[model samples]
Target: MATIKITTESVAALTKSAVPNKTTFYFDNELAGFGLYRTTTGTGTYFAEFRPVAGGSKKRLKLGRVGTLKANEAREAARRAIANAALGKDLAQNRSDERASLTVEELVSKYIEEYVAEHKKASTAGLYRMLLKKHVKPRLGSIKATSLTRVDVQRAHALMTREARVSANRAIKLLSAAYGWGSRHGHVQEGMNPASGIKLNEEEGRERFLTTAEMLAIGNAMIEAETIGLPVDAGTTKHAPKGQLVVMSPYATAAIRLLMLTGARLREILNLRWSEVDLERGVLRLPDSKTGKKTVFLPTAAVDIIKGLTKLGSYMIAGESAGTKHEKPRSDLKRPWAAICKRAGVNGVRIHDLRHTFASTGVGDQMGLPVIGTLLGHADPSTTQRYAHLADEAARRAVEAIGGKIAAAMNGGK
Candidate 1:
């Protein structure tokens, strides 16, 4: 080691020199209190070290090769390191400590790998991945988990609300779950969940159902559209829009028809295996339902629809591809249903509303509350009480029938 009267330019020249291994130079400069000397150790590589104090134990740290670390900046850094050492402090330890602090990206990765992947179902896990990828990760992945604030969560929620309220709610729910998992495992400190209180006001009350006139109009339109499409070649189109298929099984049509006619839940109709239908008995056996499995007797018209559908395929509801078992039956009701509704001029009514239509029409027809409940597969009779006007109308009809008899007897006695 040699103590050279050092300047920034002198250190730069020394760092630029070519030599057979690492080199060191002690320099004194106004900008760089300590300067380094380094040279090429092998092809294209060089190393250098610097210390501020001339006679102090060498704090030899590697500086990069000829072109990488610019001479001026390296000299300036060398000066700062020397200055720190003169004050008996280690700059390297401070860098290491800063690097060790937890970042949001690191915590999210650990939470997914350790908690979500291990415990959640494949479908549910996929949903979580989607929520995090679309909503959470972009906003907060780079933030430190321990330092996550309610404001960060609120900002994410506000952005999501512009896209969709339901989706915003789902994103918030998923984020809460992730944070809860972190808290349970001691990754996050105790506090109220930022996502906990946010609520999305969705469209509530009973779903809208199409009326009988609407159903007739829909059916006639589907027939006319098919007649119109007869001239077109099948291969001409790449893909039909949802619910727009031209040809359909009588069974599928009836299944959809019954869905509108009787207002049965889509899953109730779709999940109907051949084993569940008793054509001769006129009773459908639901092994389980949303309200728990109970036997529901089909009305004569509904039974007629079931009989027509029994001929379509092994499954009660058939898909586009015939003679193949659908991984899950009754998956989609695209094209044909859309064509039907389009012809009817009713827009934005979902297939599920067929059941709603059934309930609504029954209520309109003055069916008793208990009868409507049974027809709609409600386990609790009280659930059917919302349509109490139907029962009131039935009671009025009964009184009218008795009143006519009483009037006849009174007239006869007079």
Candidate 2:
């Protein structure tokens, strides 16, 4: 060990200093616990050395490499580190603890690996991963989980809300789930969820039903996009990689049509298997659904559409490519649906709204609430209550008919 007063001058000279056979250390005369070391391979780093006040083994905490950290900054860091050591803190252990505290990015990654990969379906997990990469990770990933505050969460959610309210709500919901999972599983501190109590933006559930004209426009646009390419905004101020040509996908077309014809969840449609569809019975027996195993009766129109399609091994709407992860059924509906809507001038409607319209049209026809529930595969009665107004109108008509007959009887009696 060489004793030297560590100054800018001293550190500058030490940059060229390295031992041929072994590692060497230079002790700082002014700072007791501070020093610089150089390896035989010419790797130089600054470190702070201290023994615990409670009488333990000597601990060394690495500050940074030469040229990366200035001598003064390293010395100041070392000073603080040594003071903490004298106060019964283990600098090395503290460092280890800090590293162990997961950042938001790390938390989501771990969540995807541990919980999602094991528990969720591939399609479901893929959506979570997509949100993490595109939304959560980019915005709040670098922030440590323990360091996250309510304000930080609110700000992040607010920013996303400005971009897209529905997307913002979904992202926040997923974020909350992730935070809860992390906390429960010890990825974050117990009983600490910064996302807790952060009020989510009110997302009005859409019940937009496409009118006859709108439907015709949409159908025509789908044809146009499938035949030629649909012109899309491509999400750019400049040029986009995929260009303005959003070539429509046949699978997406089928998916959208099926959604319109049969009121089913998007995932149910995307993950529909050949085994599930009972052509003879004119129904689908989905063993897995948003609620549970459900029997979605196929209308003659929906069944005809299904019959018109070519068989694509195991799935009604199989993905393109013979062998790949995405080679199953369709997994997404963003681009094709966007093209259809944009070209057709049918804006402010989501794929889920197609399901809503199915129920809406059913209600208009005075379909029983229980029957509609069965059709939509709603596990809860409350789920069907959103369309209760249809039942109300039917009840009103029945009452009027009964009252009119009673009035006629009274007039005849008089």
Top of the candidates by lDDT: 2
* Candidate 2 local Cα displacement, residue 165, angstroms: 2.5
Candidate number achieving the greatest TM-score relative to the actual structure: 2
For all candidates in order, the CA lDDT equals 0.63, 0.80
In angstroms, the error of model 1 at 124 is: 8.0
What is the C-alpha lDDT profile of model 2 across 1-414, one tens digit per residue?
A: 999998889888877655546788989999998998888888778889999899968988787777767889889989989999899877677655754777988887887878888988765788788888877887899998778888998999888887778777777777888877775444565456788788888766667778878889989988887777665573211234455665565767888888998998888888888778888899989987877688888889888878877776677786765245556666678877876887788989999889888888887777789989888988898989998987798778877878988988989944
| Weakest 10 consecutive residues of candidate 1 by summed lDDT | 229-238
- Candidate RMSDs in Å, in order, are 20.4, 17.0
Model 2 ranges off by over 4 Å? 1-101, 121-123, 219-251, 322-326, 342-345, 401-414
Local accuracy of candidate 1 as per-residue lDDT tens digits, 328-384: 566656655665665567888888877776776777667667778888888888887
